[model samples]
Target chain A: MADATDSSDPVDALLATVDDGDVAFDGLRLEPVADGDDGRFALETPTLDRSTFGRSELRDVLETVEEYVTNWYYWQGDVGGEGTARRAFLRWCERAPVVGEAVTAPSAETTLEANRTARETANGTAPETTAEADQSLQVPQRQDALRDGIDREWGQLCITARFVDVDEPDGVRVYDLWHVDDADSDVADLEVYDDPRTAREIATTDEDGRYRPLKTAPTLPSGWAFTGLSGDELVETVGSVYPATIANWHRERLGELDVDHWLETAERQTGIYDVVDELPRDAVEWMADACCVDSQCLRRREWEYEEGDELDVDGGDGPFPCREPCSLVVAAARKWAILESETERTYELELTTSEFNQLGELIDAVAEGRTDEIREADLGDGANRYRARYLRAKRFDDDGLEARKRPEEY
Target chain B: MQALVVAAHGSHLNPDASDPTYAHADAIRETGAFDEVREAFWKEEPHFREVIRTLESEEVFVVPLFISEGYFTEQVIPRELRLEGWDPEQWDSDGTSATEVTLSVGDANKTVHYCGPVGTHDAMTDVIVGRAERVTEDPDVGEGFGLAVVGHGTERNENSAKAIEYHTDRIRERDRFDEVQALFMDEEPEVDDVTDFFESEDVVVVPLFVADGYHTQEDIPEDMGLTDDFRLGWDVPAAVDGHRIWYAGAVGTEDLMADVVLERAADAGAELGDAIEIVRAGAGGSVTEPADVDGTAGTTKTGD
Candidate 1:
């Protein structure tokens, strides 16, 4: 509900906020990147750009990052030290949802309407989409495949993380990526090696502070039903969580302009700061982060909201594979189905009391996540349907009768 | 004869962690089906490498006791087991026989079939809910007050947390609590955060951890901001902050483990022929001792 003719141009203000680390989950991504050839980036690319630290420290920073990746014991707990940039780059990727089959620039008026819809969605109310997101997704798949061609050229990207442990059974090695290489840099993207193994090694961490296997992650999957659903829904959900200001704006501005258009804009433009070129700093960034749209990040990110701060959460209604501790039980059920595919279908998981309890315990032990363990039980059915159980507590009298207390006295 | 190795990621830190598998192995014995039933570990005695070699049976059914399908259950265990020659499609689901060892039985009756991990059953939800309820003395703790399930969280993979949430949701669906929240030690909505997360003026916290470790006695309650006398029973006085807190033993401590383990064994055995003979792990002494297993204080508690 920005003023139709406010003196302070919202875009310029928004861009300034992006520069100050504002992230919007409900509107267009408003990132201020170094736009490269032909207007993809902004002008700050060539000349000295805005930064808190000097460029002279880039090598030292990069080396510090290497040392941390190579050894957690060294710099993991250290503050103000240069570290991995993978996080910074991934944040960039999170904003830059690979655009495909370029369309003519959306008119300023069209964008204005889109931004409004995004604002509405930011307020936790539902806005039905007539235009299919499925359409956008399809466009990307076709274009990416077509552009890459049948005999595709694979691009190498370097990624790194802190080392937890190393286990090699067959030839494959999997490294747990806690801190990625480009986590601290303003440069939004990373250039990593294509091969997963090489990626692990090159982006290695040390024993004390960090380490990454030279291995790379698997190529992005072709059909992303589960993953896409999880991440996209989160993005959309956090985008739509009730923002205090937007709600206020809507309540007051309902009779002023086109409410529907505003709602639509907000819905489509979620995380505009996280994903766009010139996002402004606003309360929405703070709010949607609590709403957490990217499901993959749920149960994974750990930062406490200050006292008196309301939490925006990734609702329990997030995508599969869920974050921990929910993932612990869910993965157990999934493992039952997948490993025993020959006999038990997905529906007939034979969760023993102990494993079931273990799974539940793992979930409860977690600190922050939207959904509880129970939701996962109801997910897959008919063999794909999973089963789980945990230990129930109580004291038995000499008579072996179960004792009970009233619901409120305890 | 084919054999199924029930591999548990055993912990030397907490003996209770491995209790269920040992109990389950006993249940499988009464039916006398498998040529071999054993517990191997990633940490405890008889490590994975050692356990594989102990499988005198050629065709071994390697079943991991992990609650996740992540890297470990899928990639690491399979790789360690050298299952390239074993077609999952061809392997037996019952602990019957294996072809890897000429001595290994391959019959649905005699073969060693590897069953899936005991993580995907609806029955487990019942056990978890039941345990959470039993742990408190405060009537307010069970059916209505906010229920928070705390688990150990690590940044290794998303599957770990997914597995935990799967259980909490199950309990929530029963309509037992005014609110049910899943929190993690390493993640958000932490044990301490639950008190704040709870809009319900007061809440009962349940530690869903697998053992009676530092997390249970210290981290969990500390997070809850409780002080002295904040013992884990119903209406326990808080030592730090005088919050009425109920301490529940690790949900895994339910004493009915023997029965459930037996049921699983029977199910696996039934898949094979009905006339399988039970071979006890310790030929002389009973593995199914039905002796007291201290489920509390991590001590001996008789299985009901």
Candidate 2:
């Protein structure tokens, strides 16, 4: 219930003015009383004074309790008046969004978004991680890979390549390079090319038509061509063009006919998969693909006969919501994610992606100093040393370091 | 193919109020990552219903241009986009059409896989910094010395500050800046506190509000002691004493906002494929349903 003494004087004044502005609302409902006391004038909405605007004008509605606050703390009762004003404010504070929510709503979320937009133009000290991440992210990775391929082939094709044209359907764009270069340099992975190698490749193709990795760095073209090259002499440049494979999509449900067949068959024949089984192999496969969760992982967790060693957690995906609202799960998952993320960095492999990686991939994927990529690869195979579930542990040295392993493995 | 729709809470009282947003949209459209750029508002020429009704593309990428993720972001935009109860495959208006519409919270398509709103881009900070530069560029003629950023700060959304703070911080970093501060139409670092808190040479007060409305024209000026716009000879001081002040039009007042709004109608020429055939929807930016402005909505140029 609202503070009994609020009197709706200040709030009422706000409503009156805001309404007079004729701010059209899809559904505007202002309930003077949240306690469901509509008939009584004791809790009449400030807008109730209008003859055209009826009681229902505030139904299915939004409660925009805009207090004519002198300061930001008025709704929070921080202004500190003794009697009715303070009491009413305390009640207002009850309805006022919590401090964290307000902060998250106003600051973190807003800053993150606007910072993203102004990222290109704004000259602000890249305040925090999110902005930094965008800086790295905006760099086209696939193009970088192609450039890297070219660089390895030709030797630092062009790291200083200004974007001549990034938006191209040809899978490649051209950049004007001052010089031509040799194509076979292994250091390609260390750089970025001005244009996709294909563009340079086409322009400087030798008579044999063999893609000379190090085509002499081509002559300059117009608009944001390779400006200046730093490090390593040779006016000649080597390059490679690698196919942009669809790698690690955030969500992908594809090429799983086997599971779909299983689901369809089960849905028709036994009819059990629909009710009892629910998730047919095909359906599970699709979900796995959609979620980017491995089919093997899904299969291992679902099968009844599997040892506890196969599963990471006791409950499987049940604990996770396939759907969201999930604020609880999202928040919890965020903690685990953050832990994994930070921990992954120390690993030799660079488990989680971060902006700093562009400084270069992590030396290792150390979940707990487990040396990232190498460690995970070394711990390879879907083999389970645990009791019932599969143990997905990376090697600290040879043996896994921490965390409760699968039951059988334990 | 992401169709970026810059949705806004429109104003019924005035059309010019939508100008700033259209301007911003125009700037974004030139970037060209979006398959289409459009704007949907609660009011003004093209109402929300007509905008959504006009979506010609299979998918729409909605970016709520609101500064906060409050009632509008959480409730209204999602509700309007019909995001509630949407199954991924069927999340679109026609389910199987591949015509999809995603509601990006703020501009983080980095996580969502879709190219989202410009808010997340560091490049956009350039706009704010640029806007501020406009004020600080000249004192007697342009905004010089004192720089005041007037934003609509809400306690509910910390995001509103991202724009204000980003611009303020960026300008403050410059050598030319005498002083750069942020003031809100609402909440803390408010208009009232401008004189007491901020210390700068010449004040250039830029309205963070998307449009010139009650707050920008009426409230902000009144708070800054320019209470009387009607006076002629006195010369409206951008600031009092050494603290000079200037006014930068709302960031949203760009001409592109109109294109963003017009883009919502997929059939509206700016769309891909087959031309949008409307009877009288010819060139001048006019519409019959919600009333026109001598020109048809679809035929109007992309932005102001």
Per-prediction DockQ, in order? 0.01, 0.01
Per-residue C-alpha lDDT of model 1 across residues B103-207, encoded as one tens digit per residue: 122211123334444443344455455555455433334554666766676677665666567667887887878788888889775666555666654455555
lDDT, candidate 2, A1-410, per-residue tens = 22212334433432443433332110122223334434211222223332233344432122332211211122212222221122221221122211111112233533343333222112232323221111121112323432332221111223322222334211222223322243223333224344332233343333444322211212222122232331111111221211000110001111111111223222332211124234423333333332223211211123211223222223223111111111122222233333443322232332334323412322222212223224333323222123112222332335553333334333
lDDT of 2 by residue, B64-136 (tens): 5554323454444554344534343332222111222333322122111122223323333444444545434
- Give the Cα lDDT of each candidate: 0.36, 0.34
After superposing candidate 1 on the true structure, give the runs of residues whose Cα lies further than 4 Å from its correct spot. A1-410, B1-4, B12-20, B27-35, B53-62, B85-116, B137-141, B199-204, B226-243, B257-304
Model 1 interface DockQ: 0.01
Restricted to chain B, the TM-score per model reads 0.65, 0.62
